[model samples]
Target: MNAFQTAAERLIQADASHTPCEPLRDLIGEADQIAAYRVQEMVTQARLDAGRRIVGRKIGLTSRAVQAQLGVGSPDHGALLDDMAYADREPIPLSRFLQPRVEAEVAFVLDRDLDVEMANVADVIRATAFVLPAIEVVDSRITDWDIRVTDTIADNASGGAFVLGTTPRALSEVDLPAIGMAIETADQVVSTGAGVACLGSPVAAVVWLARALATQETPLRAGDVILSGALGPVVPVTTPGSFCARLSGLGQVSAVFTQGEDA
Candidate 1:
């Protein structure tokens, strides 16, 4: 095996074990895109072996600021397991994550496949069954996100968990771009954004995610839940309290972080 492939295997082993490893020792930096992605493939396979269901996928770096910060023009993709998904308004424990943060989002539940080479935004709308408001709970273990973009990508796009809200809308009725999100905590409005914040529109983000996944020969399936990444600002889920986000026309979605296992 090549050096990157070897390092990639080691990195997968470290994260799967939840055992810390010297970032440089594993040499994740040496991994190419395929090698890095292989780490995720292995990690995800382990999750599957452990009985985690393959629920869907997620689109990351949809936010402009995040894209700029990561030096990526578009976004990256990650897998979502059944265990990693939560019902809207569910209570989550802070003890379950390395470091969790929340953000508002637009989520799509697909009714049809969208792997066309020239798939347009309208194609996404038609293929989708329902659109809902959501809050993505992102967790990173790469030491304060103090790593390169490649590192995060190999680490499964920093994906941990996500919550999709109750209210669902037909793709035909709502305007994706103009859908506004009100993200708040402790009675203070932290920040706000719309679907447009996600690469002009969440549909565009979904398209990018689809195309990228195709390169890996991984197809987005029907009934798959796709989180269009975070809109507005991301807030740390440190303190125990109620965290909520309301998307205009799409209604509300929330998660409560309690001190102990309220599961």
Candidate 2:
């Protein structure tokens, strides 16, 4: 019933399959908090109905630059489904995306449910069974995608798919903050970062993500995967021969893109 919901319903109707669609910025005008969340809620359900099974969750805007880029001081939350996750060294069909990019991150596989305020930074580390290096493939459906912050929020915060690497260490064995990550392309190492990039430590991002999910009456369940946010600048997918990321304790995860096909 809000401008954003009205616009989102129309947008989903136009491109429910996740293909590129016209930006509904004009119809949305300046969306307030309710409108912003409404759009996200609608898209979340639409995705589930489209056969995307909710696997876990992801937190975004952990970095100051990302917050500024998205024009919000706070982070946002979105559900990650099984179909959205990829194994290391797997092939991802680029044609399935509108405009997809990758982010290096530390991923956690939780051993127990993290419910509401009951879950804190320390709780996150304790509940985490293992940590691994990951590459999240983010996609956007809006046209130009050069819009303002509010536009992206209404666009479901650009929630996309993710690919995880081998579990290199148990959460209890290593320090999450000290974890390092390097993203490489066939050309060279495009970016290097650390786990601390995720707001002091990855747990900090997890705490925030769990709390955000709690607000929706959805408590994070046991065995759910949580991506603590990007550890470095997001790299655009131009010519994808192959890409891999190495996290300190985590081994590595990779994605290969064949030539002659759109990447």
Candidate 3:
């Protein structure tokens, strides 16, 4: 098998066995982004073949802290599958993830197609129907969360699951770059940040994603939910608890994780 297929199989096996695998960077090389993305495509196709449906896309590493943590200079994108979505107040079983982490973010639901050659902030704002506070449950199949840029890209940007707030606000009602965010778990504020931390603004991150997807020939469509990266550092979901993140003006969203026995 080719290197990309081999790498894809490794991740698939890890996912099926509910076990974390070693980093793909070693086999795919550290900086070969194209090769890494090819592996991601293979993995994505495998999921599709198994009847999983793609609902939207998610941007990752938009935060400086996340970029620094992953040692990547630029951001990456991933497919958000229908099975990866959890409703508000829904209990997420811990058995579904291996070494999971959570981040607070702003999510955008598009109203129109973003099929232009390059999308700008204006295009994003015009296409967006509304925005909501979101909690992204990021999990890595790579063991110990040890990943480089290419490793993460091939792992579908470490995409796992997401929960979105019900209270949606239009762009005019909230300032994307100035909104504050605080995530609390176990009744303690665990992570805090502002919209500016997400690639200057959440709108800007969407713009980047739209343009990137356009270049890849997969444009953003109406009703597509876009998770615009993390506003703050990701907190590890080590224990069963609820993580509630409140975004100023955008309201709040919570991820309630439960043990397998409770499910």
List candidate 1 stretches off by more than 4 Å.
1-26, 261-263
Off by over 4 Å in 2: 10-19, 29-31, 258-263
Worst 10 residues of 2 by lDDT: 254-263
Residue 115 deviation, candidate 3, in Å? 0.9
> Model 3, range 19-124, lDDT digits (tens) per residue?
9999997789988988988999899999999999889999998977767776677789999998899988789998899989999999999999999978888888
How does each model score on lDDT? 0.77, 0.76, 0.91
Model 1 lDDT vs. the true structure?
0.77
How far does residue 46 in candidate 1 sit from its true spot (Å)? 1.2
Name the candidate, 1 or 3, with the larger TM-score value.
3
Model 2 global lDDT (CA atoms, 0 to 1): 0.76
Best candidate according to lDDT:
3
User: How does residue 177 of candidate 1 score in lDDT?
Assistant: 88
Q: Quote the positional error of residue 123 for candidate 1 in Å.
A: 2.2
Compose the digit string of candidate 2's lDDT tens values, residues 1-263: 86656767865764556557776667665435456667767877887888767888888778888777656777776678777777887777776666778889888888888886657777777777888788988777777566555556666667667888877578778787898888889768988888788888888888887887777778888889888889988878866568888777777888765444333
TM-score of each: 0.90, 0.89, 0.97
lDDT of 2 at 222: 85
Which is superior by TM-score, 1 or 2?
1
Give the Cα-based TM-score of candidate 1 against the true structure.
Answer: 0.90
